[model samples]
Every structure is written in C-alpha cells, then in structure tokens.
Target: MITILNSDKNEVQKLGDLKPGDRAEIIGFEKAPVDFENFLHRLYEVGFLQGSILEVLQEAPYSRDPISIRIKEATYALRRAEANLIQVKLCE
Candidate 1:
C-alpha cells in the first residue's frame, strides 16, 4: 500500500490503480509486497527515482498489465507487479 499526501489530504493506493492521463510523483517504495526483497535498486535504475513527476500515457486495455508511463523525457512500459513497488502522490 502507498500513502499519498495530496492537497493536505491523504490518498492511499498502489501504482497499479492509476489510469491513463493521471498525474503523480514518485514518493518511494513499499518493501514487503514488491517483486522481490531487493527490487528497489533496479527500480531506481529504471528511472523510478524519488521526486520524479510521471504521467500515465497508456495501458493495455484487455490485460492492464503493461502500462506506459512518461517520466522526465523518456517513456517506458511497466508491469502492474513491477509498478506496485512505487509510491506516488496524485495531483489534484
């Protein structure tokens, strides 16, 4: 579970819950439920760094597994399982 503080309110959700066109910023990670114990380092390497603002661009409608997100000046597809590790603050 990810806890997001937005506009003085708290919104708790996992990265997999975001839909296309939603805007959010990377907060950190949730250690226990992630793919593995030490997946944080790999996530950071793939631009999941803190304070980065990301925009959801698209998602596989049928499967909803691989979602496309835009971060910085690049784009990447991330699986729902992989995305769950990221904690984000949704913009209102």
Candidate 2:
C-alpha cells in the first residue's frame, strides 16, 4: 500500500546515482507534487518501502536506463526515472 513519506536530508542519494555493488538503505521518497504522487506510490509498492536494505547489483552496459537492485531475496529492475524517486543512504 502507498503512504506519505519524506526523504532523508543527509547522506541520501537517489537510486539512479548508485554504482554497481553499492549498498544503501531505503530512506523514503522525494517529495512529489500532488500530480506526481501516484508515481511515487507505485515505486513504494515495488519494494522501495522505508527501511529496506538494497544493493546495486548491476547497471546496463549501454544506456544504463534500467538498473538492477536486490532487496532481500528478490531482484528488481527499475528505470532510472523511477529510481530517482526513491531516497537511499549510501553505505561505506
């Protein structure tokens, strides 16, 4: 289900910014305009929900539009535009 959320203010990066093998925790969603809220809701339902741990498994060799992310035992492929809506804290 979708819910209201606010992104973290510090150490947070958009998922599209992650390089392969990078790790991060799902902090929340970037604030969206009322019209764009539905898009964030869809992303949330796709396992980008708060507190989920994720890793950048791979990036497309070419345009890098669709990136692969692993959360627990499942892998999710997301478009860069969709990944940009999710906020994450990069891990060292």
lDDT of 1 by residue, 1-92 (tens): 99675553247556767889988888777775544656667667768788888888999989987999998778888887778878888866
Record all residue pairs in model 1 with backbone atoms less than 3 Å apart, i.e. clashing: none
What's the lDDT for all of these models?
0.78, 0.81
By lDDT, who's the top model here?
A: 2
Residue 79 accuracy (lDDT) in model 2 = 80
Q: Could you tell me how far off, in angstroms, the CA of residue 65 lies in candidate 2 after the best superposition?
A: 1.9
List candidate 2 stretches off by more than 4 Å: 1-10, 33-39
Expressed as tens digits, the lDDT of each residue in 1-92 for candidate 2 is 99545444357789888888888988888877798788777666776789988998988888976899998778888887778888889764
Which candidate number maximizes TM-score? 1
Superposition-based RMSD of candidate 1 using all C-alpha atoms, in angstroms: 6.2
TM-score of model 1 (CA atoms): 0.75
